[model samples]
Target: MRIYLYILAGLSSALIGWNIGQFFLTDIGLFKEFPEVTLFPCIAISLACGMVMNEIFISNPTRPKLSWRIAKTPLLIAVGLGTLAGLISGGISQILFLPQIRFPTPIVRIIGWLLIGASVGLAEGLTWRWHSMEAGDPKRFWQRFKVSVLGASTASLFAAAIFELIRTTLGAMPAEFKGVEDPLGFSILGLLLGLTFSITNSPSYLGALRAGTGFEYTGENYEDIDPNLQPVNKSSPCIDKSILKFVNNGDAYEIEEGLSIQLPGTGTVRIGSAVKKANIYIPGLPLHVADLELKNRDAILKPNRVAFNCIEVNGERLTSGDDIRRLKHNYVLTFYSEKKDGIKEPKIYRFVYYNRFLDPQA
Candidate 1:
């Protein structure tokens, strides 16, 4: 697909250049006497077409590698359709309203037709601006509309200038258009065009400026959003693997700083810690409940001062009854609930840490 577009883009450009430079700039009758002189222009036009197509056609073609490939089907289509449309428009204007539409040189008139056509075609799709036009508010829509125009104009300027530059380098450009023949002018124009393309395509610099917040990929349609208003880091939605398993329910919920979950049973089995309230507090649960909190990548289990003597880990009773302790992986925690039938067999829970560094199935 790209190769086909490249060929078409190159051919359209070459036709526009050949007509303007060879037929209009020099005598057609002297071609046999001066074939050598015109050969350079022919080569220049070919090179120009190739260069333009390579720059505009391929996906990510702007990289420094020599681009025999490109993605500029739109440009080629535009030049062809735009030229034909312009020719028709010009013919109609000449016949009905404007007598001044005629040019002395037929080749010159044809070249004009192609150039105008190319501009129209290029302008139509080159700038993604429908969203800007459909923007809900008038002020913002106008802003985007202006940006669209600027972007299209910038691309067209580069295309027209580069096309002429290639022709001039081949010594095929006519004297009338030689005023823009300066290398410095071409260089500046190229730099500006490159800058515009880069600025528009890049998501960080301009996206940050436009969004005015931490970057987020908030939408699905790229065309609906301005190119300059998206994040460089496109994020995808996924489940957080860092989680704490609920032993009683078999539910795995994500673990984060200040996280808390309640395990429901005879009493609330609170998971996670707090200073004022237990994460799992049931006033009537006969067992003294402590909060199990995951913080700083560590699980903290602490008992209230009044329930200090009630906590036990891995079948060993906790000696430091009032202090917080780390809940290690695979360790068993037992809680004894005081009841009318006296202290019964304690309910048991095991601690398991879901390691994020481990691979899948680890």
Candidate 2:
């Protein structure tokens, strides 16, 4: 469902942008004075494409709703990069297709559209954050750049080639719809660029975290169920049985159910009670209970000082000072909290980790 929304957003934004550009170029007489004036429409299309792509990237179900204030910085960066790309590609295309240059008309159109698609892809790639990379990871930028640019460009080239074939083989349309080709072509390019990027960046499921037998209540007894937690198969076999719930207690939101968090193949994810800070937020736990690091398909659980005496993995208490334990399939992490009566209850919350990639059942 979400993927379909993304594709729709991409296609619509591109079509609208292209129409806006066309209006300015033909209707407003901007292109009649100078051929180089085509850059304006390119800029419009690129800016719209950039904004939509960035919005899709930053969206998260567990996070707060996005507002203009929260999304401005990244959106601005995307716009700037996208505009620059548009300028370079548009300028180059114009120069290459000049009458004096004698370039083949079909070849020129194909190259121009390909460049436009690549520029949008490049901007999106540059703004993307690689979740698997930690600070100072040297390969991060290069990896993102390579994947985004190549994927987008290839998709765009394919779209342009198809559009060219349709235009040449089908001949011109009716006089009333004579100028519809550019907008239609741009829309196709946008759809393909977005589709290719999303397919390439789809998450590879390492496994999931399920509520263990010892797990307690997820929310207050009187609280209504969260709509986002509605039981539905997310299509991933590992997380088919898992459900997520968000509990708001005025100050912050908490994860009531053991949600399946995508553990990056490499990098550390903090597990704690801090809203918006912890990768996996468990209510009533310390702000920083532990760090779960993935290395070579192994999950390393390191308990922090505040949670040393409270955390137990597979029924063994975690001690203070850098004690790290490896997690296995069906291993339960039990968290304890003292009740108002001063009794320390065991198994306040239990998270069972399962790695389907290596499991025989998978």
Best-fitting candidate, measured by lDDT?
2
TM-score of each: 0.26, 0.56
lDDT (C-alpha) at residue 98 in model 1? 32
Q: Write the per-residue lDDT of candidate 1 for residues 1-362, one digit (tens) a residue.
A: 54444434444544544444445336655444433234223323332333334434343345433222222443454445444544453443334333464543334423432333334323333422221111332443455445534653555456555655565575665676665443333233333333443333221111000111111334463334653343233231111122222221223222212222222212222432222233332222333456555443455676656654556666677666567776554444544443436646543332323311111111
CA lDDT of every candidate: 0.37, 0.58
Query: Which tens-of-lDDT digit does each residue in 1-362 have in candidate 2?
Result: 65575567667767766666667677887765444346533543554454344444434433434334344554666666566656666676677677899878777667666666666666665544422221022464566568777887798788888888777755756655646777677777777766776665453335445554433443342225662343232111121112221111221223335333334566777766665466665556676788887786688888887678878888888777477888887788877653445556643767777653221111
Every candidate's CA RMSD: 18.6, 13.6
Let me know the TM-score candidate 1 reaches against the reference structure. Answer: 0.26
Per-candidate total of colliding backbone pairs: 10, 0
lDDT for model 2: 0.58
